[model samples]
Target: MAEFEAERRMPAEAEQVFAIVGDLDRLSEWMPTPIGVRQTGDGEVHADVDSRDVHADGLVGVRPEQLRLEWGSEDSPDYAGWLQVEHAEPGHSSVVMHLSFLGDQPEARRHGSAAGEVRQWLDDALAQLERVVAGTS
Candidate 1:
């Protein structure tokens, strides 16, 4: 299993952050990835690559009180993670994204490997997300 976590301070309320990440469909917007997303009832969303990447369909677990998005995928059989937002203070929030992918496909190995690209992608995504959310408010 490979796990990665990145944290940042966002200039927005935890609620705003939660709402943004909750819309799993906008994933590709902030994260430089080509994700095709479709709503799968409730708040869950099925995301894929080229529509053929069907294994990673799942939901963004949103905990309003905790200000987080515990994300997981149905792909590759064993993948789970989360994005957390903490109320750092009255007008600021701390964000943390933790992801774990279980496999041994070199490209899916530990960080600094092929999987590093995805890790970095998420890092950039979170940064962009912070900017986007701050902009709206």
Candidate 2:
């Protein structure tokens, strides 16, 4: 799998950041596109996501203790990722996003050949997340 990690520091409390990121339905507010999330089970287990322009029918795992969310392609498990928030500096928190995708896919195929795009998208998503957190702060 081709993978990359991106980090962003936000001026918000760790628990607050976790609240925002931990809510699966709020992903679209920061992500590039709307994420349609449905509870697949317990808050600590899985959630189903339908990001029409991105991953469709993806399964996400939530680890609240670590403030992390993990996801993988439901169809083939070819795409996967991790999103986390950690306490940082004094009052601020840091967010880290790790994403991986199976290589050698056609451009026509979304996840196969878009590593760079995915990285950039995550960067933007983090920035937007900061703004959202700041507004609520």
TM-score of each: 0.78, 0.77
Candidate 1: segments with Cα more than 4 A from true spot: 24-28, 50-55, 111-113
lDDT of 1 at 56: 53
Worst 10 residues of 2 by lDDT: 43-52
Best by TM-score: 1
| Residue 117, model 1: Cα distance from true site in angstroms | 0.4
Model 2: lDDT to the true structure: 0.71
Residue 95, candidate 2: alpha-carbon lDDT: 94
> Which ten contiguous residues of candidate 1 have the minimum total lDDT?
48-57
Q: Which stretches of candidate 2 lie over 4 Å from their true place?
A: 33-55, 106-113
- The number of clashing residue pairs in model 1 is 1
**Model number with the top lDDT:** 2
Tens-place lDDT per residue, model 1, 30-86, is: 664555556676767777654224445686666777766676765555677788877
